[model samples]
Target chain A: MASNEEILAGLAEIVNEETGLATDAVELDKSFTEDLDIDSISMMTIVVNAEEKFGVRIPDEEVKNLKTVGDAVNFISNAQA
Target chain B: MARKVVITGLGATTPIGGDVPTMWKNALKGVSGAHTLEDEWVAKYDLPVHFAARCSTPALEVLSRVEAKRMDPSTQFGVIAAREAWADSGITEIDHDRLAVAFATGIGGVWTLLDAWDTLREKGPRRVLPMTVPMLMPNGVAAAVSLDLGARAGAHTPVSACASGTEAMHLGLELIRSGKADVVVCGGAEAAIHPMPLAAFSSMQALSRRNDDPEHASRPYDRDRDGFVMGEGAGALVLEAEEHAIARGARIYAELAGTSVTADAYHITAPDPEGLGATRALKAAMFDGRIQAEDVVHVNAHATSTPVGDKPEYTALRAALGAHVDNVAVSATKSQMGHLLGASGAVEAVLTVLAVYERQAPLTINLENQDPEIPLDVVTSARKLPAGDIVALSNSFGFGGHNAVIAVRNV
Candidate 1:
């Protein structure tokens, strides 16, 4: 299983690819909708791409809980374990 | 009095050129945009017709990665052309509520739709991108343009196959005349140069099979012409009310004198051999513009180089103009740039506006032996028009027997 840092890096990469946001700016404290300014459609795209990258199933219902970068990283790390 | 609508700015990302000036210059010089298809799908599928006129410059080169990712290729072309048109119009300030967009597409987001289907089949439903519906919708281009320009008056999409683009212009004219919008961006875009469209069009015998000589494949009015060459691109025009244009000190290209659209109700794929519907559209357009047959000096014919298609357009012209048809200098532009489908009418409208404004008609290349049936004076080379109040017609006919004709008068 990957560590929390690795999951955060992978998720940030997906967000960067989808939203053209700088990977470094996608820190744990940054919110996907507020800080990153990612819309719902883009958020879905990021989630799917993140699922594929991290080899985890990010269910549609679980997407709303991934509000911040840390929330997504923790979920992905826990799911992979 | 009805408000006069004029073409204030023009833009196009065509097979021959990336912008209006370049497209216009190359058209006059008789440049052919058709070439052999380089896609692996051609060899994989072993398609019969293996050539198309793709955009000279890819849309990704101009649009940002994020922007290009969200939009399908068709919407990308439309946005590129619309941005150029908006910038060309030099209108920095306008009430967002008074601006409108009437963009069209014959086949919208084919690439996105097919890709989504492929993803669904291979990777299951979860893999399908969420933007598929928004991108695949026929009005996607119009919506994208509306969002980009903040046009709130209306974002309309008129899907009439190849006549879609010209119909957008017609709708824009009406919008301004009815005092609905002060500025209306009208255009059509098409990017269906995919393996499925190529195969489908080939099956229907609508595409030319001159694989060996792709350059001369689209020879409109030529006796040896077989069929049209498929092309992909977009064309846009910023149309504003005459008084508004003057008050803003905008450079008016020409007056959008009049427009008319009709249906044959005769055939779904084939035009009426008698050309009755097209003839009525032509005559009605002239009447709407208050233009006499003698006043019309040029025509941008909807001659897609198909054997049957070329003759019917001539029949319509002859019926509408009578003997004066012999005097009109006609240019079959598809001969050079190939057929742009829905975007054909809009691009041809831009060319027709330039023809009237510059008093010169672009050449129609590869016409070695003009078909006797189409006895209209086809402009085989750059030709000059009379230096007076002149009017020109840009004709576009689509499948489903739709005919749209627009008249542009010199300002």
Candidate 2:
């Protein structure tokens, strides 16, 4: 299973790449909607890319709960475990 | 009285050029944009036709990766052209409420629609991108441009096949006449060079089948005329009320004196042989401009190089302009640029505005044996117009029997 640190790093990279944001702006505590300006469509893109990267399928119903970067990282780490 | 409208800026990402100046220069030199399509799908699908007029610069070259991925090719072209026009206008401060957009596309986002369907059939619904619906919509370009420019007055899309672009101009003129927007960014874009549309157009016998020589395939008014060559690109113009433009000290290109749109209930795809609807449209455009036919020295004809499509436009011109049609130096720009479908009228309108401003008409290419039936004076070489107040009409007709005409005059 991917560790929390590794999952956070992967999520940061995927969010930055998908939304054209800097890695520093994609902090674990920052909300994707408020801080990163990642809209719903681009969030989906991040999920799709992250799924391919981590080999984990994040279900659609779980998407709304992953509001902050930390939430995304924890969700990915637990899903992998 | 209607408020006077003037074109303040012009932009085009066409087969001949990526910008307006380059397109105008190449058009005068009689350069052909047609070439044998080099896509692998040409061989994969084994399409009957082998040539098309692609944009001189690909959309990917002008747009960022993420931006391009989010938009369909038609919206990409529209945004590219609209941004150029807005920048060219040199208006840094804009009243968001006073701005509007009217963009036209004949077959909007055909590539995206078909590609998504292919994905659904091959990989299931989960594989399809979330942006597919917005990207494939007909009003996508209008919405994209409006959002890009922060236009709040309204965003409109007119889908009248080939006449769509000219119809957009008509809408823009009316919008201003009714005081809905002080400034309007209007034009047309198309990106339908996919294998499906190519095969479908070929099946309808609407596309020219000159596989060996791509350049000469779009020979409008030539006795050996076949059918139109499919081309993809976009053209945009920034239109402002005459007073607003003068107050801003913006450079004026030409006056959009008048515009009209009409429909022919005659047929689904073919034009009326007598050109009654087209003639009425032309006459109404001239009447709207309050200009006599003799004042109209040039015409940018919608001669798409089709066997049946070419002559009706001539008959319409003769009926609308009477003997003045003989003196008019008609230039069929599609002879070089190929038929842009929905974008053709606006592109030709830009050329017509330039012609009226510069007093020079672009040359027509590949008219080796001029069809005698079309008695109008086709400008074989670049010709100079009389240096005075002059008006030029740009004509466009579409598949649903739509006719649109706009008159531009020297300011």
Fnat, model by model in order, equals 0.77, 0.46
My TM-score estimates for the predictions, one after another, are 0.99, 0.97
DockQ of 1: 0.86
Off by over 4 Å in 1: none
Best by DockQ: 1
For candidate 2, list the clashing residue pairs, or say none.
Answer: none
TM-score of model 1 vs. true structure: 0.99
Number of backbone collisions per candidate: 0, 0
Quantify all predictions' global Cα lDDT against the true fold.
0.93, 0.91
Residues B283-304 of candidate 1: C-alpha lDDT, one tens digit per residue? 9899989999999999999999
Say which docking band candidate 2 falls in.
Answer: medium
lDDT of 2 by residue, A33-74 (tens): 998888998888788788878988899999999989998998
Question: How do the residues B1-411 of candidate 2 rate in per-residue lDDT, one tens digit apiece?
Answer: 789999998889899988899999998999999999999999999999999999999998999877888889989999999998889888788789999999999999898999999998997776687889999999999999999999999999999999999999999998888899989999999999999999999999999999999999999999999999999999998999888899889999999999999998999999999999999999999999998999999999999999999999999999999988999999999988888988888788889989998999998999999899987799989699899899999999999999999999999
Cα RMSDs of all predictions? 0.8, 1.5
